[model samples]
Target: MTEAEFIAALRRMPLHPGAHGLMDDSAVIDAGPLVVTTDTLVEGVHFLPQDPPGDVAWKLVATNLSDLAAKGALVEGVLLNYPLGDSAWDHAFLDGLSLALARFDARLIGGDTVSLRGPRVLTLTAFGREAAAPVRSGARAGDALWVTGTIGDAGLGLAIAMGGTGPEALRDAYRRPQPRLTEGRALAPVVHAMMDVSDGLLIDAARMAQASGLAVTIDLDAVRLSPAARALGGEDRAARLAAATAGDDYELLFALPPDVTPPVAATRVGRFDAGAGLSLFDTAGPIPLPPRLGFEHAAPR
Candidate 1:
């Protein structure tokens, strides 16, 4: 079954009391406002087999933290699911995992390790604390949409890792994504809605729009691209569209009142409107929606 189908199947089963109806990325527990999120990365799927094990470990931790960040929670600890591999690779992964946890001020309290005969799979469950988890469904019409950092850098980074030419910064972005933990917590109070842009900018925005039951009109010219991404994607309508649809950027995308300036570095790229669906436009005029929005695991057969 496809990933979405599998998730849907799980939703049909009786859910744990704290489960968020399988709607949000993380689930909230009744115990002291704890929130938890889990993500799994598989070899040759999420990451290239040739990718460094240390980087893989870094990504595994950062991605889960990003989910917690979206909930406006402070990460307290993580539970690791590590599959044993060769000694050297396993050691490298542990070292990287240690550095990542240290950097985020989170501890690895507990986990499971087991031997696997197939592709390497790494999973992490992050625990966080917050009085209330921010909801993506909170966006409203007339909210200004904003995105942290530049978009499309990670997509270019993936290309560099795949033998395509690119700068090291781009490659580093793809390998080690910086989760917006501090920013998420800071913005939670003022923003109307918030979510991490792990997928493409356009697709994630569409999700927020759908959740809010409003239309999102994105101005393509306002979408930010790194120097490396600009060089790789060029400065045309199609190029900008390509950047918008490229996924794996872990920056936070949010909506706020137009008068409220973001406390952190961000760019205003769009606005939520009183309608359903999403619309794309540029300086010249409206642009046609792409056939495919972003990374879709369960595509129509």
Candidate 2:
């Protein structure tokens, strides 16, 4: 069967509470008082075989946890959907996951297991509590654009892993990406809208602006880069990697009113203008946007 057809099989299963449909990773359920979120990651798509299983498990769990973080949800627990390979592989993966869960007091409730003929896939459903979680489309036109942590490190880290002249210190960027959970939780309460930067910063910025019905203008000179990222491109070439092709940063991107100060080391790289569409401004001027796009899934590694 085709991939799409294979996915359609889950539709035959009986639905339960919180299940949006058989197709969703997250379900809407009442946890006494809040909403929740869940996300999943596949083997080849989310991580490389060369990457350690420990890191793979962490990424799988943390990526979903980041979603809850964006919504100001206090993490209650996580349900792991682990597709086993060998017993040893599964045990080691869980060992790594145990460390992360313990760090946040998140217990693994329960999930099903299945054997796969192909590569490994990890799915996680993270539940949290909040009276009102941050929604993606709540920003106003004058909301300030901000992000926690520096951009481009993870992108350059991937380049290094793929033999693109990046340093070892930066290599941890690909091996271990930190989900800005605390930052997201803090920002959600005050900001208009918030999201974690899994894709390239410029692209995610554009998405936030678009979802909130405003234009985003990023100042190329204003972006903060890790020393490792700066060393990779050399001199002043951040404009080359600032927004395009970078992925897995896992930091929060948010919007706040003009008068508010960011709680973290947030940079004002852009603004929500009165119009629609994103404008990337470098010293030379605004770079023309690519038609109908940003970093899409499987657009050539």
Candidate 3:
């Protein structure tokens, strides 16, 4: 089954009201401002097998926290599901986990561990608090689309990790992504909808538009690229498209009224309209949609 099929199947199972039909990334429980989210990373899939254990641990924690950030929730604590591995790797992972938790001001409440088997798999569940959590489906037509921080740094970082030449900053970006918790909190009350860009920006934005029953048009020239990314990839239409489709950005993508200024620094890349699908344009006028929008999981046969 494909990812969509799997999700559709899961939707048939018993679900709580907080599940939001599993349409959103995080669950907003009615039990006193609580929000919860979980994420899993496979060694070969999410991270390179040769990557440092410490960075892997940090990535695991950050990915989950990114979900909470999209919900504009405050990080309270996390539960880790770790696999016991070699003493050296285990020790390094714990060290990285310690630093990540401390940096995020989150504590490790509890979790279960198991013996390492096959490819290493790690999971983290984060709990947070927010009175009025925003969902991706809340976006509306005429809302101006916004995104936090620069895009595509992590994509270049991934290339560096895979042995391509690049700056350490890019590599660090792919290894240790910083979740936009502060930005999310500040934008929560003002934005119509929001979500972290884990998958490619185009795909996530398309999701927001689909969920809200609207159409979105992204201005390729408007998609911001970091200095490093621009220096390496240039500012051509191809480069901008690459950045927009590269995943693991971990930045918040939100929708706000065109007249309102965002409290935090963000780039306005697109807008929603009363239509059905995503559209693309640049300084050169309309562009055809790319064949592939973003990274997606393929089910094993």
Candidate 4:
């Protein structure tokens, strides 16, 4: 089954109210003021086999925390599910996990380990606390779509990781993505809707539109790009399109009223309207949606 199909099937089973219909990034359970999220990374898929073990561990933790960030929650702790591997690689991963936990102000409370049977797979579950959390479905008509930080650097970075030449900053962007925790906490109170740009700006924005029952139009020219990205990929229409569809950017995407200034730095890339789908435009005119909006898991045949 496709990922979507699998999720749809899961929805048929009993679900906790906090699951948010299995739609949002994290599950917010009110009992403990808890916000929970989990993410999994697989070898030769989420990360290259040759990638540093420490970097892989960092990514596993950071990606899960990014979900908490989107919920505007403070880090409480994490539980890791690890597979036993080469002793050297295991030691390196633990070292990286220590650094990541310290950097994020999160504690490694507990977890389980198992023998590796095939490709390495790592999972992390993060717990956080916040009185209130925002949901992606809160976007309303006339809300301005905003995003934190730059886009597409990681996409270019991935290319460099695979032997293509580019700046070290881009390589780091791919290897170590920073979760916008502070930005999420600050924006949660003011933004109508919020989510991290994990999959891609275009696809995630489209999802927000679909969730909120509104339409969105993104101005390609308005999408932000870092100097490194522009220097390597150029700032033309193609570059902007590539950036919009490139996933792994963990920056927050939010919707706010046009008149209100965001408490944090953000780029206004689009606006929500009264209709129901995603539209794209540039200085020239409307552009067709790309065949693939972002990264999606394909089921084994």
Candidate 5:
């Protein structure tokens, strides 16, 4: 089943009210002012089999933290689920995990480790305290869509890691992702809706729109591409389109009033409307939607 279908099935199952019916990126526990999110990375599914253990560990933490960031939550700590590897690889993973946690000023509270028989799978459960109410859903018609950081850097970086030549910056972007925690904290009081762009820009935008019960129109030309992505993707409209559809960009995508500027560096890529779906536009006019919006597991056959 597709992820959406899996979630749909979950909606019918018994769950805590704090679960938000599994509709959000993270669960909001009612007992405490805490937000929690968990993410899993398999050896081949999320990362290349030969990827550095340190880099993989860093990404595992970063992705989970990104979810907490979206909730306008302050980093508390993390619980790790580690599968035992060889001594050297395990040591490198711990070093990387330590670096990431220290860089974010978050602690590793505790977790479990086990011996796996097949491919390695790493999991991290991040806990955060709600600084604000946690901006989950509030977007409205006429809200301007904004995104932080340049798009497609990590996508191009993945290409580089797969033997496609590119600048080190692009590779670094993919290897070491930066979760915009500070920016999320700053934007919590301002944005109408906010989410991290873990999928693709277009796909994530569509999700926010759907959550808000509105239509979002994205201007292809308005997206900001990193210098590294532009250099490798070429200087053309198609390159920009490719970047928008490429997943794994952990930037922030938010919506605000048309006239208000975000405190963080961001680009206005689109605007929400009183409709029910998404529309894509280029320099000329409306364009056809791409076949695949972003990464999805177990696509319908």
Candidate 6:
């Protein structure tokens, strides 16, 4: 659908009180200490048509929640932009959506839904209240780069969901990506800057470095990856590189001063330098990162 047509269709649904009548490029919600993030997933781009409808529902919600989790935001409320499908399919999708939303006691505050004549596209604008806004430019040099749990699972999970499966252990990684909500909140007060690893570790770390005007040197071997990542992710080389660059692992990647340790379990993967660039150190000299990074849906499928 055209942009205007899409907007018009969505505006017909029940909207948030602060959506400004669905006219502007921004929404003004009354959520105090608001932390806002919007994410979009398109059919044939974000997910395959043959994939289970329940999983589509789950990942759709998980991805949006991941953005909120990255910002250290609680699930205060959400505005969903759903491209309505068959009634039975919609019913099942809501069931899956409910499962994921219930995990954080979050609900759809208000949103717009409409029937689309083409592939399904889902957008979620989520908001959470924070006592203080956590910005990305707060990271500092000498601050430790930490990752909660493992990385590369979601990428591998996506790989499995597509068709090729090196192992079954990777299914949960793709189907249900958990946002590090607790870890984000715990570090917000102490950490310099925080974001979830929705993209590859290398890319996200570089983003933090660029935003903070610093450099990030990652210890590739120090990265945390699941067994499946080691297996299907090209065993050794792919594992390291994919762990370095694979996107969609919704774990927390945060920065903190050298002396301070996170109150939660984390792995120190790297350090930020005073300069502005990304270096991956894996026993040898640092490896330069490419510019075309992260998961881009608008690009070629």
The 0-to-1 C-alpha lDDT of every candidate, in the order given, reads 0.81, 0.70, 0.84, 0.84, 0.80, 0.74
Clashing pairs in 2: 18-27
Question: Could you give candidate 4's per-residue lDDT for residues 1-301 as a string of tens digits?
Answer: 2345434533443444566666766554554768888888899989999889889988898888888888888887776777877768876776777778778887654555677689998888888887258999999899999999999999998999999999999988888899988988898888899988888899899989999999999999999999999999999999999999988899999999989999999999999999998999999999999997777661111
- Tens-digit lDDT track for model 1 on 1-301? 2344434533443444455555665544544768778888999888999988889989998998988887888877776677777867766776677678778987654555677889998888888886247678888889999999998888889989999998999999999999999988888777888988877899999999999999999999999888888887687898888788887888999999888899989999999999999899998999989987787751111
> What digit string (tens of lDDT, one per residue) describes model 5 on residues 86-150?
76777677678767877887765555567778999888988888656445367889999999999
How much lDDT does candidate 3 score?
A: 0.84
What are the per-residue Cα lDDT tens digits for candidate 2 across 97-184? 7667766666554455666888887777777776247776777887788888787777777767766676877767776777777777
| Steric collisions counted per model | 0, 1, 0, 0, 0, 0
Report the candidate with higher TM-score, 1 versus 2: 1
Kindly report which residue stretches of model 3 are placed more than 4 angstroms away from their true locations once superposed.
Answer: 1-31, 298-301
lDDT value, residue 248 of candidate 4:
86
How does each model score on TM-score? 0.87, 0.83, 0.88, 0.88, 0.87, 0.85
User: Which runs in model 6 stand beyond 4 Å of their true positions?
Assistant: 1-31, 288-293, 296-301
Candidate 3 lDDT tens digits, 150-176: 999999999999999999999999899
TM-score computed on alpha carbons, candidate 1:
0.87
Question: Candidate 2, overall lDDT?
Answer: 0.70
Model 5: lDDT equals: 0.80
Candidate 2: deviation at residue 109, Å? 1.4
Q: What TM-score does prediction 5 earn?
A: 0.87
Q: Candidate 3: lDDT of 90?
A: 74
Report the candidate with higher TM-score, 3 versus 6: 3
